[model samples]
Target: ETLVLTYDVIANDGDTDSNTQTVTITITGTNDGPVASGSYEHQIVDGPGADTYDDITGQLRASDPDHEVDELTWTLPDGQGQYGTLTVNPDGSYTYEVDEAAVNGLTDGDNPVDSFTVVVTDPSGASDTRTINISLSGTNDTAEVSGVDEGEVIEAGGGDPGVPTTEGTLLAVDADNPDNRFQPDSGRGSNGYGNFVVDEDGNWSYTLDNDNPEVDALNEGDTLTDTFVVRTEDGTEAQVTITIRGTNDPAVIDGDDSGTVVEAGANGPGEPVAEGTLSSGDVDNPDNVFQLEMGEGDSGYGNFVVDESGNWSYTLDNDNPEVAALNDGDTLTDTFVVRTEDGTETQVTITIRGANDPAVIGGDDTGLVVEDDAENTVGGTLTASDVDNPDNLFEPASGVSNGGYGSFVVDANGNWTYTLDNNNIAVDALYEGETLVDSFVISTADGTSRVVEITILGRDEPEVLHPVHIHRHDSGGDLWVPEVEGFDTGSSRPSGSFDRSLDFVANWLRESSEHEGVVARLWAALKPRDRLVYTSDPFTFNLQAGTFLHTDPGASLVLEATLKSGAPLPGWLYFDRETGEFSGIPPEGYEGEVHIRVVAKDSDGREAQVQFTIKVVDEQEVGMLLEETPQDDTSNEQTLRGKAGFSAQVAAEAGGNDLQAGARALVASLQALEN
Candidate 1:
């Protein structure tokens, strides 16, 4: 079929279809797309302001409902001076940085604004753009003011609001503020606001007349409720609670009196008052028991009770008899027994008293008498009297004799006499000028007695008589002989004896030269025993001679006699061989007594004679005898007689010259008897 169909469509109005009778009809739909009314939303977030140290990175989000975006780019606004550089990221984010010079340029006065754009391209080549504004503000940072209030109000019954509004008793504040601004007369000042009064120290005060109306009028224990507050000058406030307590009133009792008393026994005159009457002014008070502080002797004796109307009587009963019998100077006391209404008793005591007696004597007086032969007389006598009984008499009752006298005899009148001896010798004679001590007891009818002593003066001269003797001869030699050989020698032979008188011869012979030879011999015999031995080696002698004789020859003989005893007697005798006589003087030193015995033998060997007691004189007399007599002459008989006479005279004058006559007689007798 290859049949082509051509048709000419007639125009709606008179179009000529004559030109074209062949009609060709072709309908083609091409892909030219309908564009949707695109809704694109783009948001631009400004980067942190482009100052130094600021966060400058910002993100931009653009959304298209109909197309996709192919790229995101950011552009800085054209008029932005070199404040910073802007960079766009693929994710629709941008970063802007201010250079050091730009940062320096943004000083206190040179603040600038920065604007930038972010462009987003869709897949269809459709583009969207958003703009962001970044502004730089000044860099001055400061702390904000805190705890401030503009104004405050307190309710009427709200108490102290405890807020730091105006300075008052309910509010205290700190003076220092953050701004350091203070105004004393202004509400914002530390001590300003309301009726507050400030002291010199800058502390604040106020009148809480409404909230704490009773604060000034309240007592210590009164109760109250209030709030307290503290505030700072900057208007900072702090609150505290305050409560008022109740006060106690002073106590009261009836009468207004403080003290009361009670009687010892009853409850009236000295009765104690009630306990509450003397109140310390306290409620529910305890009872005050009554007490008697001071008693008779101490403080506790008087009566005390609890009842004010009780009666009491005090009867002292100290139990001290001395106090009961007190005198004018006496002090007395008694204990008080207090009885209560309940019949209970307590005791208090008292005391003091005394007595005395007069003085009296306890001892007696005594006396003493002088001794019989004491040198002093008039010894003292003692008198005695009793202190208690002075009128009593003293009399002697016993006695002793003094000076060897008899007991004393007292006369009726109390005078005494002392008889010394029974033989009528006076007391004076016995005393011998000494004190005659007589002790005697003198007694009175009242039985009182005293001892007395007496002393007497004695006769001055002693009573002694010389012995009597009768003289019968003128020659004298009398002595006493001892029984022992070495004892005293017998007296010399006297011329005669006298009847009752002394011959006086012995005394005369002691002074006579005629006895010189005898005296010398006696002295030698009386020599001490140690001197008796004779020493013949040197022929030393101590001798005295009674006579010298002249013989018919021209030479003379010397007889030296000695008295001796004990042993080898004749052997001890030394005689000169040529002279037919003994020689050698006796030793010079002799003492005490010498004794000897002699025996003479006759030519026929019959014993002839014995003699005793020869006397010897001292050396002085012997020398006198030798010097006074002449050497013997043997030439003629007359010469011999003359020499013998001369020797007799020398013997008589040896002691002295008085015995010369006796010596002459002895010589004549020797001459006449020679036939």
Candidate 2:
């Protein structure tokens, strides 16, 4: 309201004095209310998707003519009608968005109220309101593809290579509208995966389009992978991945069918048999090689060799007993199966025939046997056999030569035990590689005289090397070398302690190599006593918060700890009856400290063990060091609690409180107290 007024007065005194003025009044009418404009109905999708910053304009503007400079306050309609927080700017521009929580509860086509009101009030208490008619709807959502049970496998050139066929179908729902359907986002074969496509009905199929770049590159065993997106009429999408596994061709093994060799014994009268090499090759894979199949021909004892690097050859193992017992003019065919890296196999036949008539000894004459106190048996059972008759008498020629050779015993009852003549020869003289051959006269048991030559091989003590690292140090803080008392005369000390240690190690290794067959025996004797000793501190790990690999191909493995006598297991995880390995995989959404106990016990009731920890979270996302017991069943698991045990069970199960956050808060409190 506008108004104005005026008044005048006059007076005289002694006569008196006074003044007079005119008075006027004009009133400004009561303030006019605000006016509303720019009002209209609008349609929008129901979600923010990934655009967190994008917003919807409310489009409501207002002004008051009576109080142009007075600020107007916008009052938005309340209740579920407002999707999200409505914010108004000073210039009267306001925004709104569909809240996920609100949208999640609303179904397609379900409308409660048809319109809402927006009120604008002026500073003078005058106000005006407008009706905003609203319409509710929903969008087609992404399809559910994980539940589709189907996979693709093809042998590049096999299985309808150029034809499109159904692999499986996809299923999806609009969530907001169950009747909404999903179809290919792109037309026909335009999905970038050759002709792989999804129809409106979610039928998935693919064809080998030779013109396509990826299809053109396909080989015998090359696996190819691709993905496609499908959508509903309302622009929603889902992705599917398809895999094509590749296979390789079989390997080709080529070699001569026959070979010739001179007649010779392996250790005595006959030696070196004829041999040949079989070459194998593979066409596709670069690391292709050969593998031998067992129980084929003479391969029962590995009569053939197939190296991982593709080398193939035949082996004549005279020491196999069967090969060594062959008589002159005897022949045998050894058949073996050889295969390529891809399991393609072929059978190879090899004929081994002796060209002379005679009994011969084969194989390395030298042999090894753990010392049985001061005596040991040596030599082979195949000494001699007559060609003309099955019955024959073989005995020591009434004359004794080389002493030990005649000391052996052979009887028709098969008593072919050969005892070393340690009594006749000094222990030092009966050394490794020592040769002793005694002649035996054979007479025909049936009186039939026949002549045949045979071979027999024997060996002497030989050196087999095995080395272990060691450092030398004496009680006097000095290094002891090779001549340290029992080792030498305790006089082989080096210029420096380190050098002395090096010399001692060298000497020890030399002795070890000379010990021949005794190294393993000694190591076996000393192993059990030290296995009970703890080699390191208890194994430990700090697991991160989040779900870990529980058979999910892409999920990260948080821990793979293995216990050992000394095996480095930081990079491997395996627990079986033999190894004392134990590891914990935290269930999905379960994060907390997990304490573990690993125990190892020997047959004598002696036990050794260690205790360790796994910090489920890298940092203090949790306020407390709450222990989370592993739940073997995902369906039976329970939510976390603010306190341990049963303290906060009811509050957690109430389903209204943030139990995870509450537990974190408790941890924070305890941490604060400690600090």
Candidate 3:
């Protein structure tokens, strides 16, 4: 090797003097490290539905300051990457290939970067190290799911279902995503027959909703095949199939068939009236047809018939006596059992409403009478005819004239007689040639009335009147009295005191007007108001009782009580005639209102009555004042005694001496009766 240097020199003393010199030298050249630089990038493509991919190729660009790029040899130390293999040639060319299993396992957004060391050297064996980076971009891969091939289920009404319907399991897989699972919220679907569901673990099941009416639409021995599509989270769809078989169903008859028709003769028995249609269905039969059971109908007052197509008609017997007896607004119901050919039965009710037909009466409307006649009577017969009301008769058999001239009587057969009273003032005042007319109203069973007038002709008689002498006498005498043995002086003090009290009461009641007023006031005050009593509680009611105002102190007066209907009181109730009180405990399970009527009467047959009601309830009508106790069949005597005692104590505190005396007397009388 040779070296040369060229220079120019100049002295500081002169500016015009300059020289150019050249020198030659020899040196040895040694190989230095080749500088290396390169960068590589590659993208892996995964087409839709494509699984396998080829290797990725890249160039390791390098530049050496001392040698040509071709002369710089490239070497890779550790050519293995995490996901692929990297190879570099001595010519600075390289390739990176991802493992087949790793490529197949790549999912969306999976990018892998690989790195290796590259050494560039000259022929002299001097080298420089550089890092080569290989980067790869990922592509999306397709996902897949498995399908449920076939399944079987029984239709509704096919007998008991011992086991659930089973279909094949569904499976899903994604090589790019090894942890693939089904999304249940978006993976469940339904069809007309059943619903399909898939769990997160890719397990699937199909449940038959047997309650659907479509399941019963299939006939016996019929099969229905249904198919449905299910999807995965990545929009992968699969088909599932189900086959449903059918069974027999029973015949059914509609139970609510009824009709209302106006009775015949309202318009003269024109035609038979139509009821409603009778409907029946049999799903197992062809065309769901049903036949009516023929010759099985009856009606008391009419003819009932049904046809094959479920139409019915009723024709009333207008001429029948019972049918004709029905009044206006009267109704009768006829029931008939209708059936299908399969013996399914339902009842059909037909109601007949009645209308009235006017009645006719034929007879004389006027009559004549003679005051001089021996009997002084006018008589006649009447005839009545009614289409709707047969065998009619007059309502009242006898009656009296409004005028004081006469009276009238009639029989059920319409035979009537009007007789004039000879002693009547109006009849006696009549003079010769004068006439009096009397009218009476008569009615038939149908409330049809007619007025009949009778004219009485006056006549003169020549019989003379006679008078007899009368005598009167007045006498006065003293009446004798006898004393009883027990009442002569006194037997026991209590008995004498009781007798004296009774005598005072009787005398005071008979002589004192104040006593009558007091009694009336007491009666009015004691009248019980309407009360609500709960069952299982004792009830005590004091009714208004009083004695009639009569001059005779010994007049027998009694009070009796009973139900408003004149029926005897119930066994649970007791009426004390002396106290005019009704006390009883209503038994369990008894609830209703009891209407009581109390009557006070005297020996003279005069009566005074008052009615009141006691409503019995199962629950407390008023607000509770104390804690409730369990109710049973036991009597509520404690509660009754407490109330009665409180009332008696209050009366005693109020200084009612008469009430106290009466209470004492009552107690004594009760004791005596018990003894």
Give the candidate number with the greatest TM-score.
3
lDDT comparison, 1 vs 3, better candidate: 3
Across 1-675, the per-residue lDDT of candidate 3 in tens digits comes to 334554444435457765554444445555566776655555555444436667777666656565777887888888998768888888877777777556656556777766778787877677887776655555544557665657787765534462346656667676565434656633323457777766666566677766667666666688766666655555556677778787555456663477766655533453336466766676655432445444423666666666666666666666656556667778777667665554455677767677664467778656888886887888887778876676547776665553336788977878889988776534554556766666566777776666676787877655332211011113421111112111112122221122212111111111122311212211111234566788889978665323222323234547787776455788888999888778999899999988876665556554444456778889887743222211111342112111112111111121222221222111111111100
Q: Candidates' TM-scores?
A: 0.20, 0.29, 0.35
Residue 246, candidate 2: Cα error in Å is 7.3
For model 2, residues 629-665, the per-residue Cα lDDT tens digits are: 3212246333332112212111112122222111111
User: How do all the candidates rank in terms of lDDT, highest first?
Assistant: 3, 2, 1
RMSD versus native structure for model 2: 46.0
In lDDT terms, which candidate is top? 3
Candidate 1 stretches greater than 4 Å from native: 1-70, 74-225, 229-237, 242-257, 260-675
lDDT, candidate 1, 1-675, per-residue tens: 134456875444356444434467554433222122222222222222322355477666666554443333333344243556667676666676655334533333444566665566555455566665556543322212233222332322212233223332222222122332222431212322233433322244333333233432333344444443344343434443333342322223322232222212211122222122222222212223223232242333222233322222333332233322333244444344433222223332323221111112122222333334343222223333322223333344323342224455553334555443322233323333433333344554333444344434444444332221222223543321212111122233333332222121111111223431222111111111122233332233322222221111122323223343212223334544233233334444532233432222222222211112222334332222122122222431111211111222212211321221122112222211100
- Rank order (by TM-score, best first): 3, 2, 1
